[model samples]
Target: MLTYFRQRYPTRIEIDEDGNTVEVPLSDPMLEAKLHIALSTDGRHWFPLNANEPVWDQWMRDPYVRRGPDGVWRILTTGTTDGYNRDASGPGCFFASSKDLIHWNDERTLPLMEEVRDASGNFLANNIWAPEWFYDEENEEYILIWSSSFKDAGWKESRLWYSKTKDWKNFTPAKVFFEPPYSVIDGTLLKHENAYYLFHKEEEFGAKTGERRAIRLATSKKLEGPYQIVDGDLNDGQIVPVITEGPTIIEDPENSGWLLYYDYCMTNRYGASFSKDFLNWEILDDVHFPADARHGCVSKISSEEARTLINEYNISSSTDK
Candidate 1:
C-alpha cells in the first residue's frame, strides 16, 4: 500500500447548540509510541519504521518482529497506538503479519486462545515492552518472550514472561521468566546448540557520574528454566548507556559467529555486533540503519526471517513526509 502525508490545521468552527456556541479541538493521535515513533508495513524497511501515513492510531511501543514457520513475518509489539491509555488493560502485545514486507495485516483476531499470567494470579498485564517469539523446531513449539508487568506491581518491577504453543492461533499462559528490583525490561532469547541463551537490559541503580543501564545474559539448560546469569556489562562495553538497548542476537548464516542488533538511544541509530561466543561482542557497521527523523529506530533483526524478506520477497521501500 502507498502512503500520503499532509500538514493539517485544526479549523475552528462554532456550532450553535440551543443558545451556546460549542467548539471542539480536533484531536491528533499521539505520534510516538512510548519509544518507537515510526513503524513499517515491511519489517522496518525504508526509514522511519512507522508509516509516512498515520496507521497507528493507538499508543504502540517495544515492537518485536519475527517470522513464523508458515512464511508469515509476524510483528508483536506493545500498546494499541490508538485506543488504550496503557493502564486500561487491553491487548498489550499487538500482533501484525505480512507477506511481502510491504502490506501488513493485523493478526490480533487470529483466535489466540492461550492464557498465561503472572504468579500473582493477576492475568497477563501492562508496560507491553519488547516482545520476541520463535519457532522451536525440535519441540515444534512457538515461544514468546516479552517484558510485562503484574497488574499490582510497580513499573521497575516488570518481569519477562514466556508463552509456548504449537500453533500461532493458540498460546500458553504467561509465566515469569525473569524479574527484578534490578528492573529487567526486554528479554531476547536465542536457541543455539544444546542450550537456550537470553540477553536482557536492566536499569541499574546509582553509579558513577554518567552511568545508565546494563545489558546482561542468562542461560537455561531447558526452554523452561531456572536460568543462571552468565555475564553482565552495564557500561555498553564502553559504548555508553543511551547507545545500548533492544538487543537481539542471531546466528550468521555465513559463519558460526553470532550477530547482535539494537537501537542506540543516544545517537538515535541502530547497529549490529558480532560475537564468536555469545558473551564477548563487537559491533559492526555494515548493516544499513533505518533513517527516521525520530531516532529512526529498529526494534529488532530476526536473521532467519529478515533474510528471506530481504533476499527472496519483493519488498517495497517507504518514506513518510
Candidate 2:
C-alpha cells in the first residue's frame, strides 16, 4: 500500500458509449484516485466530467461497469495488492457499487481462487484476471465471469469461470464458464437480440505459421453458456502483423449496431470496429485513446446523470483546469 503513495500507476479512461469508443488521458493516478469522469454526446470526442477529482481510490484491472437491478452502478475488476497485471496475492476480484459513478461507497472482495478448490484440495486458480458481470434479466440474477488459471495447469491454461450473485454481497461458488481448446483471457459479454456474444483474447499459434495472440468471438443462446467460437479470420483482416487483446463489446445506442473495442498492447493503442450484424466488421479509424489506457469497460448514462456526476465530482467546467 505504501507503494501507491510513492509511485503512481499509469491509468486511463477507456469507455464505449453509444457507438463510439472514447479514451481519455488522466494526468496522474493520485489526483484521479476516484477516477476522472468524461462524457461524449458524439462518442468520438470526449469532455471531462470531473476536474482532477478521484472517482475510485483502489487499484483495478480490466475494470467492468454495469448498472445493477438495485439501480447501483457497480464496477467488478480484477483486484490486486501487489505486482503488475493479475499476479497479486490478494482478493481474486474487487467490487464497488455507487449510485453515481463518482461517489462509490459500497465495496466487497471475493477470494474466489483461494476458496474454490479441486477435488485434491488444491486451488484451481490463483491469478484471477478480468472479472465482469451482467444482469440476467430472465433469471433475475447477475452472472459474473472472469479468467483464471489452475494451480495444476500453467498460466497458458487460463480459462474463464463464473458465479451468480444477487445483492453483490454473497456469490455462488465459481464454476467453469468457457474453455476453448487453447489459453485465453480478457473475456467480455454482450447480449444481442436473443443470443449472447462473447469476446475473448486467445493464445494460440496461427494455423499456417507463427505465434498468435488474437481476439476471437463466441456465441451462445443462454447466459450461462456453452459458447462456440466463430470460426474465421481472428482480426477480420484488420490489425494484421500486430496482435490484440482485451475485447469489449457494447451496443451502438445511436445506430443500433455494435462496437468492438480492443487493445493493441504492443503499440499501446486502442482499436475498434463496427458491425450491424456480428458477422461482418469494418475497422474504424479516428478513434483516439489515452496512451496509458489498457483493459477497461464502457457504459452509457443518461444526460441528467452525466450532469449530476460532473457537478458532484466538481469537474471544472473550463477544459483548461
TM-scores of all predicted structures: 0.64, 0.78
User: Residues 1-321, candidate 2, lDDT per residue (tens digit)?
Assistant: 000011234443232434232455445543122244545565544444445333556766566777777888777766664312332333367777788666677676766655666687655566677788878989888888888875332235788888888767677888889998777787888887899988888764433324557777889998888898887444442222336776777776567688777767545555677788787776778665433345646677787987776666554444333
| Candidate 2, number of clashes | 7
Model 2 Cα displacement at 189 (Å)?
A: 1.1
What is the Cα-based lDDT of residue 258 in candidate 2? 81
Model 1 C-alpha lDDT per residue in residues 201-295, reported as the tens digit of each score = 76433322234454677888788687787743436432223436667665654567876666554344555667788777666754543342221
Give the TM-score comparing model 2 with the true structure, all chains together: 0.78
In terms of lDDT, the best-performing candidate is 2
lDDT of 1: 0.53
Candidate 1, RMSD to the unseen true structure: 10.6
Per-prediction count of colliding residue pairs? 19, 7
Task: Score residue 138 of candidate 2 by CA lDDT.
Answer: 92
